[model samples]
Target: MNANHMNDIRKYLKYSILNNCNFVGHERERNQIFDLIQRTIRCGESNSALLIGPRGSGKTTLVNDVLTGFHKNKSFVSDAILVKLHGLIHTDDRLALKSATSQMNLDNAVDGKVFGSFAENLAFLLACLRTGEKHTSKSVVIILEEFDLFCAHHNQTLLYNLFDISQSAQAPICILGITCRLDVIELLEKRVKSRFSHRQFFLFPCEEDSKESPLDHTIKRIECYLSLPENSRLKINGAVRKQWNTILKALLEDKKFRSTIQRLVDVDLNERTLRNILVCFFDQL
Candidate 1:
């Protein structure tokens, strides 16, 4: 290909992979989460939230977007410290809390402290919070991914400590748990469950509007990406655009193609997956 053609291809790939994909179509859930975070920041009181959704259903993406907004705001960025933990990485309760304490960069308080015991680790976390209040007046926003894995721990000390600390700590501390399993809450211990108070947000798959089918919605999203302005660097050639239309037509008339789309939608492959599938097909074209 010529130099200009190569540049256009590069631009197209960038737009397809990064620029176009965002946390889309979760307006209600996004608003509730944003409000909770704002409330915690304003009141200087800790808040714990549970976000439940299936895999690839945009729970993590939504939370990341909210965090990005907070970071962008000058007034909130200074007072909020974002910390993320993967539950699968830290299976043990003590280890998870210790890891959080370490993230706070309170080495002076955490050093030489034996985090092997749950109480010691919990103490370290509290100390870190106290230090945060005294020094930076910052609130720690902890995002726990794979929350179901964390709930599998036997003792449930980690959940207790987190809820207790959030309630008692002077500086606000928010624990946002993201899990795929719907019944994960049933796994929490009784005391922890009561303490948590079931502050949960459920993210359902995006549904088709009254005027359109799921397939139609998917087609519309694909069309939006393909319809990027001519002035844009990302160029979609005639052949690729023709291929996309062919695929859509197949989806409408061909039994096998229709079944494939239906299966993916039934499994909760919403607009996000639609974009990914189209991008993959476009790359081949």
Candidate 2:
């Protein structure tokens, strides 16, 4: 209402926007997963890593983080290509090749008929981003989320070929494959299994880890909200803050609200029903 009060709200809003943060509950696990990917890229090991986790366990988020993080690193001069094969599920070979070529440079210089031509197309795309002059550098990581879908729907030959490309790629193509099903390897052939063995990283659910509690997570979120610049309009007085915390505790403790909470927490809940629920609960307080 007052000038000083108005100034405080504006600053808080600005801070929240600048951060654009996702307060993932499993921060420690997320960090561990990030470290493993970093080590793999640095080591230049010749193999594809599979990220196996439940659908909502942040597997895809981790993959995107690794890809975007490394690409923006100062040491990384070349481009990193992340192709979601799911998008190309029904695409023909020509369309697949076109997607690959568009993703990278498939000049006549590189053999077009190489093993797993589509995979090679991806390699060629990375190759084009090369400086041509030789120098030691981190290999270009090709992240394919839901890679197992390709194996199940299409032939397993593409994966086998990608494994081979990882071993012999000129630009050093490292495939980071993600899948929801932990038993994906059982569907793959022995050769594919052998190639993907060492690089595999399994992402566990929050319930599996003792260190990360839902309350701890909610507290962290509260901290993030509190840390917003004073000008931000998020008003959480002692009473409202306590009410918000209680709502979060209930949401996390109840499995039924897990999905709903995940969706609601990402944005401000201005819906009439949610607003009414909050009002009724606050009146009771």
Candidate 3:
């Protein structure tokens, strides 16, 4: 293939692999989080969970996939109020509360009104959600991205209040925190810990099978990512895809290539690492 063709493949591969959410791993975590949020939204039972994993473990993808599924449901679309707070953007409790209020569309209520302290304003917002009829209130789903940063806030009031809300059966609130920090659980105070559901999920890269010399689902993921449809942008025929598959087959069958992959597995051949390898391969092509 020429450099232009290779570049096209690389660009498409990156987006295809990235936009592909039908990953082979994390089935258990996906189901658990899905059901947790469903119960909170449907049954009006509050829930909280923390997703702890290093980068490229598909932590964000898993939540997004599950939430996307919920988004398809008519009731979920109508009843759910999603408030996403990022630690990088909202540096402290005050800013976090302000953003939350805005995301929840409460700005109009306080429009042209005096802005109260963070605690008072936050409590007022929570009270508004709580005032709805039991089992008929809008379900509030709060997702804290880079949750570890939220933990470092002074006094941890945001975490405390959110956790407190999730402990109640009347409030249909679900709090999902995504963080790479392993010690995030330790950051919570003793009082905040009591309200938390203590439901935590850990994610890691998939491992190779014990019997086969295969790379588990890694190769499958690559194939799924690179295969172009008949009407694909590249306008390449099935011949290119077949040739690519043949190349993959030869590499897997080659003893030296298998050894090289096994060595890469030592440092961890996660999705990100595999993508980097493909970039180099495309450059050489």
Best by lDDT: 3
TM-score for candidate 1, please give it: 0.74
Candidate ordering by TM-score (highest first):
3, 1, 2
lDDT of 3 at 235: 54
RMSD to the hidden true structure, all candidates: 5.2, 8.1, 3.6
Task: Name the regions of candidate 2 deviating beyond 4 angstroms.
Answer: 1-33, 36-43, 77-84, 87-96, 105-130, 134-138, 169-171, 218-285
Candidate with more favorable, higher TM-score: 2 or 3: 3
Task: Report residue 122 deviation for candidate 3 (angstroms).
Answer: 2.7
Residue-wise lDDT of candidate 3 within 1-285, one digit each (tens)? Answer: 566665666777767665666555667778898998999788878899999989877788788888888888999977878889999999998788888889888887766756455546665676566545553678889999999999889989899888876775445889999999998889898998888888999876663423323364665666666665566576555777567657767766688866777787777777776767876775575
What lDDT tens digits, residue by residue, belong to model 2 across residues 22-109? 4355555567656655654566454467777776555765566555666677655443344455424524444544555544545454
> Candidate 3, clashing residue pairs?
none
Local error of candidate 3 at residue 139 (angstroms): 1.2
- Any idea what lDDT model 3 has? 0.77
Candidate 1 wrongly placed segments (more than 4 Å): 1-21, 114-120, 129-136, 207-213, 216-268
225-249 per-residue lDDT for model 1 (tens digits):
5543445554667665455456555
At residue 138, what lDDT does model 2 achieve?
41
